[model samples]
Target: MALLLKEFSPAELDRIIEMAWEDRTPFEAIRHQFGLTEESVKATMKAQLKFSSYKRWRQRVEHCRTKHLKKRDDSITRFRCSRQRAISGNRISKR
Candidate 1:
């Protein structure tokens, strides 16, 4: 199993993982609610779920969620800093 760098409550962690597994629950949706990145969500999944399930889920996400990738790129961001920082394909674009 993968290790998480920080500890989370059972309920909080469970909800995040459950949301990650939902088809309608975009990474953006999770971020809007939790302020976590897609990488964070995937790391949480690897840490909490079985390896096979994680693999299948990643495959499903890559194949089925292309529109989300585009939408995620176009979404607005609000960071506490003077300017928000968000990236797509290593290029930074601000709202």
Candidate 2:
């Protein structure tokens, strides 16, 4: 697992974890952004997080339609909320 994570910086790993926890961010998005497959993401999560937290995350994602591209509705294209402001300097603005 260390070998798998060696490529990512701490900030990038944190971002990946943040993306993984989001309900609407699909594994495909993570893959596209980080080049980590679904299994790799799962493994990373398992390695980095507490066992309980990992289990909870696994349970949450197990059957979630929004976490898988094929399971998501075609009409729902964007993952981020329309009202959400972009992050700048690691701070998300309230617009």
Candidate 3:
């Protein structure tokens, strides 16, 4: 899993970390975009973020109702924010 994560550029890694922190983005979306499982994402977060930050993120995720599709409200749909540009080839477009 470390090797797989190492394959990504710094920009991609940043985006993965960003997505993981977003309340509206589910683990499935990260998996779809980065081919990382939830555990893999957790590992990445733990390795990349400071210990305190990682613990905070874990606690937030545990309580974030929108982080999992099953736990999210049905009215909410989509992964990215409505105004965000489309991501292509794992790159987020700049406005």
Candidate 4:
């Protein structure tokens, strides 16, 4: 996992964490963007978050239909909100 940590910059990791926490961002999306599998993302979240928070996150994600591509609706193609502010040069701006 240290090797995986080395692969991402602090900003990238932050982005990954943010994405992981989003209800619509599936594990496959994280895998596609960062090469981290669902398990890896879970591990990273566990390592980064407090134990209770991690437990709550796990409970929330465990059965969330939107967190897995296979379980998500076919019509949903994008993970982010259409009204979401743009991200530029690693900085996410509010609308």
Q: How does residue 91 of candidate 1 score in lDDT? A: 36
Q: Kindly indicate the candidate among 1 and 3 with the higher TM-score.
A: 3
Question: Which ten residues in a row are the worst by lDDT in model 2?
Answer: 83-92
Give per-residue CA lDDT, model 1, range 43-80, as digits (tens): 88887779999999899877654316454444434312
Q: After superposing candidate 3 on the true structure, give the runs of residues whose Cα lies further than 4 Å from its correct spot.
A: none
For candidate 2, give the lDDT of residue 15: 87
Could you give candidate 3's per-residue lDDT for residues 24-57 as a string of tens digits? 8999999998889999999999999999999999
Best by TM-score: 3
Q: Write the per-residue lDDT of candidate 4 for residues 8-75, one digit (tens) a residue.
A: 88889989889889998889878877788999999999987899999999999987899998889999
What TM-score would each prediction reach against the true structure? 0.61, 0.85, 0.88, 0.84
Task: Please give the lDDT score for candidate 1.
Answer: 0.64
lDDT of each: 0.64, 0.88, 0.90, 0.86
Ranking by lDDT: 3, 2, 4, 1
Residue 34 in model 4: lDDT: 79
Clashes of 1: 0
Q: Tens-digit lDDT track for model 2 on 2-55?
A: 898999889989988998998888998888878899999999999999999999
Q: Give the TM-score of candidate 1.
A: 0.61
Model 2, runs deviating above 4 Å: 87-95
Winner by lDDT between candidate 3 and candidate 2: 3
Best by lDDT: 3
